[model samples]
Target: MLKKFAKQTLVAVSLAVSIPVFAASYTIGTGSQSGTYYPLGGILAKIWSENIDDFDMRAEVTAASVENTIKVATGKQLVGIAQGNVVLQANEGVKPFPRKMDVSVLFALYPNAVQFMVPADSDIHSISDLKGKRISLGAPGSGTRVSSVNILSTLGINESDVKPQSLNYTATTNALANGQIDAGVIVGSLGVGAITELALTRNIRILSFSEDDMQKIIAANPSYQPLEAPAETYKNVPAFTTPAVWNVLVVNKNMPQEQAYEMTKVAFDNMKKIRQVVGVTKFTTLENMNKLSGIALHPGAQQYLDEQMKK
Candidate 1:
């Protein structure tokens, strides 16, 4: 009886040793609370936490794309949502970033439309009309500010040509309503909440880019593509042309391959459900998945894509 009991105890120890223990936690950096990235990040975190065994994940609210990229690159966060142009610039050590970041792309999320708004009665009819008027480019470190600056520079409109105010989406809306700003540059998916709210009370106009202006913008930054804000997106507004950049999911280069693979798999598998929360999911297709602007794809994401292609 003593021999049998010792044998059973040894078997239990061996069994325990064979069982795999996995305890991993990660954070996804997203944009402001009022923006789509924040809520989308929450949905992804929930999906990952629920589906991945022994995984703990959370989403952090950040200052938007540029900040998200830097955080992810520096390992302050495991993953982040960033604009494609900004990601490319970060990878190349551009103005906003001090040096090249070791980051990899997971996938493209959506196109961020550059929506320039003015009060309906404002005299600013086109991008050119903003000269000598007050314009609210987005907050200093935000992707919107970079895009706005690029657009303005391409049009030969120097900083000295207009009075520029650094404001966020909500602040820009309030300023427009209060007549504190003549125009504001907001970058987001169609029918952004802030713009919707501002349009409900104040008559708003979305500026369109002329063909020449579009060419100039494209020439300056190939990452930007022509996009249109569909008619009826806002009250009494018509479809108008603008420039857009894709928002991508990025991870630090050091993220484990297995973890990144599983993360990508979970995201693509739940694409339909994710779309219910993030309208941008409509853009997250296999085609978009293959498009990595300037940034390299994480090896794990590439492995998953290869496996997907086989099926």
Candidate 2:
């Protein structure tokens, strides 16, 4: 009887030791391989995976916000980088979100200035002025595509009005410089390398939003905020002023609250260091974070904020 009891105990111990413990890992869906968001996402993945033992993390090159939100909603992605206003629209079943999506905001990341580029001598001067011209709206299912359509729709312009080319930022820049496309639209902070490089080698103008355009977009969506990108943001360009937008970090609703909580803490704790990462300058502060995130904060992120408040 004693030998049998010992054997049963040993078998139970062996079973426990042999069964694998599942370790949680998260994937952040960013943008195209060549874009600023990808590298920034990789930086986040490194920080989360290396410093935080609670969860494993990595960044994936994806179609950006519009698709990223859908991915998060459907459980294909654990986290996503999204445009702020777009996130609100997604949750409300507007624009890119054909149905309401099930993702929550972790925090606002950075300003995504609405940058319009045209040849130095082009006749295109404003949003409405681009009528009958060739433009790159970005690849289908991308955040840039959704935002471009939204802004153009507000201006009473449709895909038919311009030769809309679906291309990524790198492709758009090349097309613009080569005179293949008259204009390209980008959404990100000023000083992003692609824009800076384009500006340095060519005469490019960043279009401004007229008061009418601002009013129309804001009236259509209240989450839209008026922003300004100062001049000389890139080499050889004089200080220029224009209206802009922002981006947010989102997480799946089904993500483990414990992992989300720790990830958020790690993000805020290391946000200062995150700024040093490429294309992350505008996302370095809690204030900016609060201003740009549109969705309801996740419980995990809220917990971190709560702890911050107590301090």
Tens digit per residue, CA lDDT, model 2, 1-311: 99999999999999999998765777889997667778888888888887876557789888788888888889988888878777788788876678888878887777777777888788987888889999999888787888888889877999899889998888999999999999998877667777888887898887778778888887876666677666677755555445466677877766677867888888777767677776455555665556654466888777777778787
Clash pairs (backbone) in predicted model 2: 231-239, 231-240, 232-239
Error of 1 at 291 (Å): 2.7
- Given candidate 1, what's the lDDT at residue 25? 84
TM-score result, candidate 2: 0.89
Tens digit per residue, CA lDDT, model 1, 82-199: 7888889888988888998888899888899999999888788899898998999998778888888888989999778999998988888899999998999998888778888888
TM-score of each: 0.90, 0.89
Model 2 misplacement above 4 A: 1-22
